[model samples]
Target: MAVASNYLLDTGPLSILCSFPLNASPYIYAILQYTKITLADSVIIEAGRGKIWRIVSPLFKTGEIESTTTPKEPEILDLSYGNDLGLGERSTIKSAMQMGLTAIIDDRDAFVVANRFAVHPIGFQDWMVMLSREVNLPTKMAIEIVRSSANQFPKMFLAHILKLLSE
Candidate 1:
């Protein structure tokens, strides 16, 4: 089996996935095939009792979604003062910084903040494409999934991603 790549998931990416059809199992499963997704405690709290939580709850129980606590380290304190980021985003970025993991953050502001901190961030759209190309998920299905969540992404950004997928 191929070793899975680990990624820190911020609430933005989870929210985007939550916007998918009732049960996001298929897509989630596809991702889990080659990626280990970790969610910080703050991310769970931020998700709350919503569609996102509902979908992730089972995964958490099944160990498909790993849970982690945000360290009270200096990195978190630095993030706290850097931007108007939410608890989840800050925790995710800080965790990524300490762990040397890439973060999946779809929000533009959070993405920028992560970059500024030298925590490499992947947008959800780009992540989808990466899974398709690197993990050998069907390209058509990947594009379909991206289109399904089109409304959640910015128009220009979505268009650009679509063009990349086409190429």
Candidate 2:
């Protein structure tokens, strides 16, 4: 059997995945069940004593989740200079490129950087659409999850999601 494509998440996507209200956003859970979800150790450090880890720790404990570290890629970070962003975004993008995995990043600068490196970058709204389509999540429930998490999403992205939900 063919393995599914792996998705490497940054702090933003990981936080959103773990932030859904209890009992809602089952699509998030379903996606986790179906995909090889990974997080860079830098992202975990950035999440830092938050609810994201609390809700997802059981999965990690059960070996359903995986974490990795990118060491240091000075060349990649050097290319990202003058962007005025931190190393976390740089590292996330670099790690994804190095591993040839899709990356989930919500920050605009980070998204741009990832795109520049030719690494596919997706945001929360993209996840909503993807999860809905790939896992057969009900459109209504996916919309609700996107709407409820709108505040955590970029405005442009939220608008696009609303449009998709409306259609």
- Against the reference, the lDDT scores of all candidates come to 0.79, 0.72
lDDT of 2 at 69: 82
lDDT per residue for candidate 1 within 6-67, as digits (tens), equals 78899878876666652445466666767788998999999999778878899989988898
Q: Give the Å error, residue 36, model 1.
A: 1.8
The whole-model C-alpha lDDT of candidate 1 against the native structure comes to 0.79
How well does each candidate superpose onto the true structure, as a TM-score? 0.86, 0.81
In candidate 2, what are the lDDT values of residues 90-118, reduced to their tens digit? 76787897788788888888788777778
Please report the TM-score between candidate 2 and the true structure.
0.81
Model 1, runs deviating above 4 Å: 1-3, 22-26, 75-83
Error of 1 at 25 (Å): 5.2
Distance from true position, residue 157, model 1, in Å?
1.8
